[model samples]
Target: MRKEKVHINIVVIGHVDSGKSTTTGHLIYKLGGIDKRVIERFEKEAAEMNKRSFKYAWVLDKLKAERERGITIDIALWKFETTKYYCTVIDAPGHRDFIKNMITGTSQADCAVLIIDSTTGGFEAGISKDGQTREHALLAFTLGVKQMICCCNKRVIERFEKEAAEMNKRSFKYAWVLDKLKAERERGITIDIALWKFETTKYYCTVIDAPGHRDFIKNMITGTSQADCAVLIIDSTTGGFEAGISKDGQTREHALLAFTLGVKQMICCCNKMDATTPKYSKARYDEIVKEVSSYLKKVGYNPDKIPFVPISGFEGDNMIERSTNLDWYKGPTLLEALDLIQEPKRPTDKPLRLPLQDVYKIGGIGTVPVGRVETGVLKPGMVVTFGPTGLTTEVKSVEMHHEALQEALPGDNVGFNVKNVAVKDLKRGFVASNSKEDPAKEAASFTSQVIIMNHPGQIGNGYAPVLDCHTSHIAVKFAEILTKIDRRSGKELEKEPKFLKNGDAGFVKMIPTKPMVVETFSEYPPLGRFAVRDMRQTVAVGVIKSVEKKDPTGAKVTKAAAKKK
Candidate 1:
């Protein structure tokens, strides 16, 4: 009688730079080998990629190199054979965003391999100092992974109950991570956004591919505030689409936020068509399109203009090339639709409005302010004005990543030395602009169209919350509710509503509690969108419709700036 092979799932986890992937690769090479067919598959791919070597080791080395360079391979499982069993390994990334993925991966694990870098400060910086390492261990123990092998450098230590107890005890201090983990268990897949760079036949595009709804306020609001197009990737499986489009799901929120934040173009990609019932059912596609188009219309996007592309992200169907699987539907491939998007007009001709993120005082350099140029152009030796107090100074030099730049355009984060501004004179939240043009000023009050997303109580007059806009965080009070309008049509519903509740869309005038610069969304978009944060969470988001500028006088003009005119 032939002996049967036992199958096991293993999760490999560790802190950043702890060589978890390296150790996993080493084990795969040493303990066992992959299937012959799998090796041949890799060899075929290698040949197609023009690699001369057909060895399995070379393919593993290539994957390792990709991982070392911080390119995430999305491969959730790696199968290999041990002398005793067939092992399926899940190697988790050492980061905050992938914690959910780690947990999901760990839940299936029969055993876990914890890799720790024992070299000098590496151990201290990785385990003792990093909360993610502790979180990973805690999750492994909590998820009931039957066994664990701790690989510290070369030596391996197997400890079962005692190690679990230690992990449980040491991780009590990270109560925040614990709470988040608990919430994640309840909420399911909350993901982070990634900037995808791809080249089509027409345009070289940078896509802000959002992962999920949770923490989107911090990511989309705080980072990558602008996008030309929003691609809503839908799950086409039986229950996958329902879960995603459900309340508190990523689909609805992402679409709503994208529309509200002024993404001009939208693409609804019905993905995973290969896994759909009956395999690429046009009925399923039509049903999803019908449902999604209506939902998007509610979110203020004209569904007529949006492209609904059916694709299997995994099966390569209708993603780049045409697939016969989805032959019944012919609209556009994901790549084709991406190319069809109208290119956004670059905001280079507008007045310079660079909001200061931080002001640094270097040893050799006097005073330097680092910020992203939101509009117009920033060049060396231009007279730049700092807003709110209207402190004017000449740009001594402009540099990005220590390299000197002739000019910085919109979206370029650069640091420039100023002619005669002290460190105390400039700070975060101050706007830098062309002194000669219509410069930014302190906002006395701004009227905005606000959509309350999350709030425990009603918001009325005198309700002040911190507004995060363009590297600025300052409390702004709801001075008055101008009107409550239908979010989709922007048509007036109620005049001067006394109180605004969650999911209510209203035009409100806001007064900042401190000196802050804001611009109209029609002009400077980066300076216009604001997130309302209260009680340590984002409660609402708004776009500035109009700004009442406070004319600043007695402004200090630096000697170099004064001489420019």
Candidate 2:
């Protein structure tokens, strides 16, 4: 027997009503990890609340408003054990407004599954229409997901499935994912869930299913951030169909983005294979394979690199076991792909860093800080300081679930008690570190790199947004826009521009509303971080470029100095 349990943190995401909860329910049921009585109790509660279709999600939703809304509003966590591994699922909401909640969930996972709807497929429309595909893919790469697989679902709906396959077929035109669409095309709605997984060789595994909807794109982001591998579902009957493709268009940008997100391995499940008559025909399967192969090549991948299977989740075809109808298609079952996936290793060598995501005072326990340990070892009695705020605290104890531990390594979701800190002062985004270093104090004059985004009018020299930094947020205005540069290449552009574009990166001198904690990027990356946001969306994300050696503006007058003046 293995003495140590292999722990895997997994997050399930996709568009709303794309079977995220249903799939999770099935996994829990098959694993025999969750209590049947608990499920039964939820079923009863759901019935009382008039949520007749409620199942496993009801047990986790926890919020009354969410129960009434019939969608996950926040992240709900549950654990299960397999013969080979112990897994935890961080289920997140599939709506746009709940993106913050999704980020919270994704930041904790070792791997993710990108769930695609084989029925509807990847689309040029929906909330996912805009720059979401590129944004999602970029975020995944930035977070360092090593491997991935795509899980495509909803093959039962042939019309929707045809549209999805067509979308994949047409996404091949652009040099990069972003160049494929203009502003108008980006707003179109996506309806299917594109599922995939990512992982490292021996470190960790994650899966994310990109949902096809504007409303559910947030779920996709959350899922991708937490994934190690992915799965792409396909509707066998509609393979190679053209519903979402425009007559004038020719390219496959959607599938390319999935691959770019570091998904090397793939499990293509041709769902609802037995639904049609003239079933198990050689010509049909061959034709489907050829069309899919052609599309894969156009997107710069070899057919041999991916394993394609046939299954039905509802009828119990090839989900966990081999299917009888699709004897011609010989491939691993869905469960086989999941079982064969390796776990990703936790990075232990890096310095321990934990971002203060949430902090609350428990009734019995004192000030408890809740956050995922990003790196390093966190032990009890460890002296740590919070953010640029320089608030210091001593760890009194550490607890995971109900069990208390002396220390917690990386990937452990443990809450620890801290002394001499007010609950209100220890705000979110503050980083906790083992070494003793004073947090950066906000300077009256500091330099920053800014990107100008949405506003009613043009943003000129003096642009302002609320700067949200570690444990502190204050109004900050750019006193001057120094020079503009490309966000990606980091190359400086032409002469000074009055207003910055949506994604332009530029250096600027900033003036804060009040003295807050901040540090020069050279000294401390954590304290140097800042995000600029308006009332609606994030306008810019920047780091402290430099701090003025002397205050440029002598607005503050010292009482003792007034006599000398």
Candidate 3:
């Protein structure tokens, strides 16, 4: 008579010493949720501080000054329940001044786990040069955490004896164990961010244990921007997933920023595979599923629906059984591929929008704001408007995770309240909408299409940068580039291509140095997708398609009807 469960939040990130809180305290003590007399009092205080290999990272580092300065500093909530969902497990904080409590615990996660660190200078010093594992997988697809699970952690690969004596003094190949783990990433080591949960027999899960540490890529982009599907974790020994996927890899920049933050489902796993040798872990799992399906189809994804598996998360085998050492691999195990992922599909007829993000005021309850609707249906008295600051107001009440919600739909992360609007006339990327439906504009010039992915040189035209979109970031420019296409057959390969660089694929036009709003990606694909950034990476990724507006000048009634003709 009681079967309601189904809830999830998960966050955990990576880098700084990479074992992400001892593989999330050994996967929440192998799912029984600890308490064997609190792991023998944390193994008698880590064997009297000899640090008995950090007793499962002191089960979430419970600060005795974080287990005598072993690391993990803040955000570490927990809760477990599985058998089909009801998890929480945040666990962020991998050092660097507790990355703003790991971006406020990855902005209240929804999914993410990204650990990495398979020993040997730990996954090339957590993704090399000050690695926050490719900036927490590009800040979890720029704060939209569309699902990720990337584990790796090989339980400290038998404490890499001097990275296996500098990889047998450089002949163990795999590019000399990635040039001796990039020369030991400036003396690396230190880790945390741990969470745990498990379930199958259908849905309900949570797991975020991020942190890979290039000084905490802004808390791994505020915890992989709220994932939806990702489970990379390589390390199948032999050179641990070829030193985390070479070319200064954060596992290929966290699987190309989790497939450009939209995560179309993935699950590579391959972990320790019982430290290799089932014929070298099935030829390093068919050479990492043929180099991660040809680098996820050259960054657009589709590698035959993605799913590699072959687990071990420290001998748990295919991660919940099913590993007769590769009986020629048959798939589904990382908890049945996390219950076959899927999820996504909330558009809800589109239109309403939302954005905003934070406004508050609440003394008696007036100008709230918040965010997360991301498309149609809001309700509660309605009227809305918002946008680049067009204002309007009305809503009055909606709430959500805290209760009172007459409507609010599409992924609901509400807050509402509104009325005449104050708290200094609202802020945070505005947007809202619904005043009369399809009511949000501003652009004055759009067009997009993009692709790029990294710049360095050749972009042409004005090229301002910083875009972001959903929850708007702003500052665009570029002005025009019109056509360059061929991102795999869009054709047109040149109509204005004087420059474009890295993986091209243009169409351009942009503009937005100010008034933004947007919508076109065939009509609001979660605020018509975007990305761009510049000096901070994320080169490009676009959408929009068309827009213009701006007219309105009237000019004294067309100069008095042209002097009365």
> Which stretches of model 3 miss by more than 4 angstroms?
1-114, 119-132, 135-152, 155-223, 226-245, 248-383, 386-441, 445-453, 462-468, 471-477, 480-509, 512-530, 533-537, 540-565
How many backbone overlaps does candidate 2 show?
92
Each model's lDDT = 0.49, 0.43, 0.51
Question: Which digits, one per residue and each the tens of the lDDT, describe model 2 over residues 1-565?
Answer: 1134555555443333333343444444444534677656555554454332344444444444444445444444445554455555544333333333333344345443333323322222111212221222222222333332323332233333544532221111110010111211122111111111222222222222233223433333333333333333333333211211111100121222223222233344333344333443445444434544444443334455445444543344555566665566566555555545456565556556666545788887778986556557788867775544555557778875546876676655557888756688776555666644332233667888665533445566776676644324467878888888886677889556787766577888888866554566555443455445454233455668888533223232223223323
Instruction: Tell me the tens digit of each residue's lDDT in model 3 across 128-171.
Output: 42334443344334334455555443432355455444322111
The TM-score-based order of candidates, best leading, equals 2, 1, 3
Question: How many angstroms is residue 384 displaced in model 2 relative to the true structure, after the best TM-score fit?
Answer: 2.4
Q: Give the TM-score of candidate 3.
A: 0.34
Ten-residue stretch with the least lDDT total in model 1: 171-180
Over the full model, what C-alpha lDDT does candidate 3 score relative to the true structure? 0.51
Better of 1 and 3 by lDDT: 3
Which residue runs of candidate 2 sit more than 4 Å off their true CA positions?
Answer: 1-6, 47-50, 81-86, 121-128, 131-135, 155-347, 420-422, 435-482, 486-489, 502-565
TM values, all candidates? 0.57, 0.62, 0.34
User: Which regions of candidate 1 are displaced past 4 Å?
Assistant: 1-197, 209-213, 278-281, 312-316, 346-349, 355-374, 386-430, 451-457, 465-475, 482-496, 501-506, 522-526, 529-545, 551-565
The all-Cα superposition gives candidate 3 an RMSD in Å to the true structure of 19.6
* Preferred candidate (lDDT higher): 1 or 2: 1
